[model samples]
Target chain A: MLERLSDKWVTLVLTGLASGPRRYSDLSRRIAGVSQKMLTQTLRGLERDGLVRRTVTPSVPVRVDYELTPLGESLMPLVAAIKGWAEANIQTVEAARKTYDAA
Target chain B: MLERLSDKWVTLVLTGLASGPRRYSDLSRRIAGVSQKMLTQTLRGLERDGLVRRTVTPSVPVRVDYELTPLGESLMPLVAAIKGWAEANIQTVEAARKTYDAA
Candidate 1:
């Protein structure tokens, strides 16, 4: 569990999926620059862990959607909190870097 | 920054320092079971990122302390928020797992 939360790609994938279920391509697009291989691996991990629900729909073409299981959605606030914190404190962190560098 | 937050040890180390400055051993103890190597590496990374401040005090014996930089402390609410979210929703996550497993 800690290992899952600790990985960089996992959090990004989980948070991306938390927005709503998305297709493999949609997630690739939304996450910006994550390779297909990484996304596939990450989604597989989430699915295996039961945090993600992958559903495939039959249509003229095949459609697959990835949604947060209740477990996955449960993590949204934590992800948001981390994101919110970054939004709020990135400047502070940047300034500290400036100061530390100057010293 | 995203990479930093998404890393488990980094978040734990940040939150651990968020409470107050601590010695390496203190953090090792407080965090339950962090390896010395991992703790040292994580602290070094945080300091390199300027989110952590490491101070060495010379006494009959030397003492070293680590505390959040203002940047690191600023991250506390978010870390707390994550912990808070986890505490509130781990049960939901757990239940979802049971249901998913049963399916």
Candidate 2:
């Protein structure tokens, strides 16, 4: 849904997983500000939406990894473009905000 | 910021203003599900973020119009892409959700 995709965590999670499969701990570490609960919820939401795939190994300790599905991968270009635009225009936005606030 | 752009109301508001300037009432009407309060908040946020421009006219009822700034207009392509992806993939996402929930 447009609403869900608009969520910041969802964008970050999707972009983060774009690189490759990552364990829970790795994801938490890589995405600096996300809490464990938030990460878990986001992954579940993405999985339910079919944008993320979760894999669990049958090893002694049992390891879990998360990666993007083909559908999710397809979303990357748009996401990346948005991210690039945001970074490039942040200063302009900030200046506008200050001017608006002053007036 | 990327986080702000990901807000659904922000996206709708930006896209709504994409066509041309719109009055507060017109925007509320055009964007079907948005409440007056939410619309005001979203627009203020967008204005603060430098994406939407708010103009006040000293006419009979003192009309206020909203339009996208150059920076905001620049984001239109990315937003359009995301909306297109969502519309195209909704069924896929829904089917995936049902499958995930059932299992």
Candidate 3:
């Protein structure tokens, strides 16, 4: 369960969608290092979890966009908090690691 | 990195220590299904990351206790929110999974 949250791409993808809906190509472009396959899988998982809403608009070319649902939006602050904590403590953590390794 | 946050045991161990300090054995017991090796590794990682404080008491039989640091405590709310979100949406995710799988 928590494993899904840990997926390397999930956070980035969710954070990307937090701003607004993005087309598949746009999301793929925005999140660096995310491969097409992984993005698809991550989006599928989020969609399956009901955290992301997917819309397909038929046209000369089908336009598909991904956006966060309220459930997914609810996760934003938690995600942000976690990110903030990590950023704030990363230096300390690195120092501790060095000390621990030396000892 | 976010990967550490997603660690299967980190959340459980951090949550376990949030209330107060506990001996190694106590933590091992409190979080069911955590193997000795994994618990030890998790604690070492948390300790290295400066999230957990390890105290070794010199005695005929030395006792070691683990507790959360301020940094670790800061993570509690974020961790709790993640746990809460997962719990609240598990059923919906399951339902979505079924729908997704069927289509």
DockQ for all models, in order? 0.36, 0.66, 0.71
Point out where model 2 deviates above 4 Å: A3-8, A33-35, B1-6
What are the per-residue Cα lDDT tens digits for candidate 2 across A11-96?
A: 88998899899999999998989999999999999999899999999998999999999999998888788778878987998899
Give the runs in model 1 whose Cα sits over 4 Å from its true position.
A2-19, A29-31, A91-103, B1-16, B24-36, B84-103
Put the candidates in DockQ order, highest first.
3, 2, 1
* Tens digits of per-residue lDDT for model 3, A1-103: 5676666588899899999999999999999999999999999988988889999999869999999998789878877777777778789888988998999
Q: Where does candidate 3 stray beyond 4 Å? A: none
**lDDT of the structure predicted as candidate 3:** 0.86
Model 2 chain B is weakest, by summed lDDT over 10 consecutive residues, at B1-10
lDDT score of residue B48 within candidate 1: 70
Report the number of the highest-TM-score candidate.
Answer: 3
Two-way DockQ contest, 2 vs 3, winner: 3
Residue A96, candidate 3: Cα error in Å is 1.4
Give one digit per residue, the lDDT tens place, for model 1 in A1-103.
5356656688788888766778988889888779989899888767766689889999868998998887677777766666677677777767766776677
| Candidate 1 pairs with clashing backbones | none
Worst 10 residues of 3 chain A by lDDT: A1-10
C-alpha RMSD in Å of predicted model 3 compared with the true structure: 1.9
